[model samples]
Target: MTSAYAAVYKEWRDDPELFWRKAAKAIDWIKAPQKIFDAGAGVYGLWFPDAVCNACANAVDRHVEAGRGDQAAIIYDSPVTGTKRTLTYAQLQEEVGTLAAVLRKHGVEKGDRVIIYMAMIPEAVIGMLACARIGAIHSVVFGGFAAQELAKRIDDCAPKLVLAASCGVEPNRVVHYKPLLDEAIELAARKPAAVLMLRRPQEPATPTQGRDFDWTAEVEAARAQGLFADCVPVAATDPLYILYTSGTTGAPKGVVRDTGGYLVALEWTMSNVYDVKPGEVFWAASDVGWVVGHSYIVYGPLIHGATTIIYEGKPVGTPDPGAFWRVIEEHGVASLFTAPTALRAIKKEDPAGTWLQRYDVSRLRALFLAGERADPDTIQWAEKILNVPVVDHWWQTETGWAIAANPLGLGMAPVKYGSPTFPMPGYDLSVVDDLGHDAGRNEMGTILLRLPLPPGNLVALWNQEARMRAGYLDDFPGFYKTGDGGYVDDDGYVFVMGRIDDVINVAGHRLSTGGMEEVIASHPDVAECAVIGMNDAIKGEQPCGFIVLKAGTSGTHERIEKELVQLVRDKVGPVAAFKTAIVVDRLPKTRSGKILRGAMKKIADHDPWTTPATIDDPAVLDDIADALKAKGI
Candidate 1:
């Protein structure tokens, strides 16, 4: 089949303004934009600078007005709590309006900031929409985040109010969120005016006198009085939300997304990238705190009038490895978007996909992997078992959407093992060497996006415009440095090897640890793996492989380690100098499933390091340390 990708890309490249202007027609605008783009506006430029719109109205009110009120808007499936609930558009509209009214009653106005620190529940989504409905900026901190980190965000945004839940239910324990929230408030320099607490039956919170408000009581009162906050018109360049990047150590950079361009871009991607029609079930198994949840889980699907799922459970442990399969079967999910780490976890627990066979996943047409590099081994495994196209796309927290993707909705290109095929419509991707010149075909270098980043991408850092320019623009003149090291192959496929820091110098040769990891993961006995460069006295740096064996693998650790060393030498060549390989039970990762390679590298080098705020489990780091010590490194 001939893919329309080439012609469509050309259409965008030839006249970018016209393309985006056409896309903007799908959204309902309070004041239509006459100026498509204003290069003199922002840190870079601005899109739809003269337009006025409301995100909540486009996502909720308009859908209801269009007579799709009976369609499912959000499907909340929490296996941890044995709960299943679905809210239709009309129902969601009512709840969102009530919450908006509550915010208005508390005096939150346009551009005021509100912080949402709740778990993966329906209210969390409601809080975000409520903020948008009244033109208030919402910043969602990851649930159960460290108090110090939360305090830092609190100080940065200086929110007028905070919305939180009492507790977060995990498979084994109920995490008390109230205490954490209180502690953070105590630590913060800037205090919120009020706190709205949602009391869960598992763990109810004590209200602070004259400060805390009950969520149920507030909403009920608002409904009884017929008080609902209507959508407020915001400038096209107005801030919608502030999301702190998870990987930061000190003060986190709050990525700010604008209203007009974000809606247009997300609406375009719904049919052009995800290929799901209105009312179709789309599930992104991610927490609302992360970029995936912000884009795919909340705004993207609803703005496109599709049913989105809020899954609160592990990929493997909610019941078994078949948990995701059951959700797919039950919800009739057309597309599943998640990190590759989730798939690796399921594959490690059930290598043969025995549990998957028990459920009918025939309704799932495509599986989209992002947030982490989708290794070929995991992708091939998912394709073999699910019998669907496993598309690996690439983007970042700053971009808010895919920079390079296969464009599944445009047409499926021939699958390449390691590349995220072709840059998306807005990104003009190029690979440059140390001196900022173009790199040779398939040669490793810093990947960059040409100037004037596409719509839906970050407009600026919250209260830090100078920092934004220094971090993204100053490094490369006229190009946005992606901070990722990769290459563009002769076929125009973009291969993101890993972060720029992941490239290590072996004597004089620069090697990509991601490439070595890809080779290590190809072993039949290997379920998951991470390759980090360890400092070496003679070679300057040497590659060390830490691997987790597949479930029920018959090979002994010693034999498999030897085989892995040989495999890297054979595939990546001896120039890799890949001699050490350790077999561990698991790897350290963040809650969002990104492998904590930097933290692992810090531990491996015996450098002073603190536990990452985003780590999934701190105990895993100790295990990694023990494994490294036993190897006599």
Candidate 2:
């Protein structure tokens, strides 16, 4: 018997237009799409071409009108600042309306750009919804981003207004946002006309005399005057937002999401992929800056009438490893979505699930992992502890939702150790060789999606059509190159090994660094590991494993290293050329919990490298350099 997931996928594959047309009915469209797709319209055609809709109305106003006014729309939990707050649908509608009025007062009109630079705060969500309400395109840059990086985004999007907070709270210190914003404005050629700064008690900022306005003052004045902005309908093909993802050329690639397509896609995922229902709490432990946060934390849950969570804390810090559990228990979170890096950090600190036992997370139905490859070791550990379906999905910032995921609402699929299940509806996944031909089963190659990418995927790069084509489409003509290297198994399970560049050539023999890391991470003493190809004059590049041991692990580092080397040799065979293994206290990661493998490789190769602006801690890079030096690499 075919699984429900497989049957639904076939239904979609049969007629994508009919499938998307059915999905579009879920949204409250001002003008429903008559044409599902227009092949000649955009970079890869367009979805819902004749539709007109307001994202904010569907997300906030409709819920209140549907008698869900008292339902909690958002739960703000900030352990770092000792703050917890909740907003009902009615309350959120009022807040978003007032903010939209304030934006209108400042001459921000439909199609005008607004940049939101805020910490994990309720107001950040309000800012985004406010922009959507007024048909203004909002671009969110991560708070505390370097002035230069922030300036690059400002120039790229050329926003008319900026929304920001006073400061961001970390476990140890406060990162002031005003200074960075000020410096960024000074650096940008195209400056925003105005800035609205939210004053936080932690570190209030002195605004620039001419350009800055107090967020509370503006919103309160608008509210007192009974000014509430109404939703403005925009064409479905209009750009909703521009989210910047890092590009190889050191320039930010702004990914544009269409209004109607985004609303439809996210709404479907909330029900099908995550199996979340309205009124139940769903938590995506990520910052508003990242794509996951944009899709799940802010847009998806709200549109679906589910109570979303904005958690401002780390997996291990800001109290302890039990922070996630506390939120789940307190909020009755039905599902949790986060990066695999977070679970590994928690496992490193509390390998025995000691912290987890303190809280009752019986309400959690499933745990969704993304952002990075979810190794088998980490998934198994989470499954053994949570006693819930730990689903590993694959997606990118370019694709707003999951590319490959096991549809929980349809029915559960059998768990595959390393695969991220099958491709979700609308994504026609193909594993192709370097020359664009289909690779055989289980053969490592580049992954591509067939032409005319589904709704919710990026419409185009902001003002850089040539770059988008050259970077993604040109490489594999007729397909959208995923840039990832992986293969489909006999059962049609897509296994994303790593980036195509991650496949290193050793003595003219290709080796997957992800394959080697899997073996090393399976060690009993290891909590997490990263394998990078080190420059070797003899073999061109040799695999070097860096392992982080679990808390209270016994035995010497040298002994563990020897065992890891032997483990990889046994699993990946002698052809892997994996001789070196180094045990480290911790691996360097970005603020979003992605291991900085590229930076690590550059360091190991003794090449010129600079600290990544997104790094969680600069000191961690120094530790890695010291470790490499100690090993005489």
Score every model by TM-score. 0.99, 0.99
Which candidate has the top score in lDDT? Answer: 1
Off by over 4 Å in 2: 247-249
What is candidate 2's lDDT per residue for 1-633, written digit by digit as tens? 235998889999999999999999999999989999999999889999999999999999999999989999999999998999999999999999999999999999999999999999999999999999999999998899888999999999999999999899999999999999999999999999999999999988999999999999999899899999999999999998999984233778899999999999999999999999999999999999999989999999999999999999998887999999999999999999999999998999999999999999999999999998898999999999999999999999999999999888888789898889999999999988777788999999999999889999999999999999999999888899999999999999999999998999999888889888888878989999999999999999999888899999988999989988888889999999888898888898878888889999999999999888888788988888999999988
Runs in model 1 with CA error above 4 Å? Answer: none
lDDT of 1 by residue, 1-633 (tens): 567999999999999999999999999999999999999989889999999999999989999999999999999999999998999999999999999999999989999999999999999999999999999999999989988999999999999999999889999999898988999999999999999999988888899888899999999999999998889999989999999999797887999999999999999999988898998999999999999999999999999999999999999989899999999999999999999999999999999999988999898999999987889999999999999999999999999999999888898899998788989999999999999999989899999999899999999999999999999999898999999999988899999999999999998999999999999999999999999998899999999999998889996899999999999999999999999999999999999999999999998999999999999889999999999989986
Kindly provide the TM-score of model 1 when superposed on the true structure, using C-alpha atoms: 0.99
Candidate-wise lDDT, in order: 0.94, 0.92
Clashes of each: 0, 0
Candidate 2 local accuracy as lDDT?
Answer: 0.92
C-alpha lDDT of candidate 1 relative to the true structure: 0.94
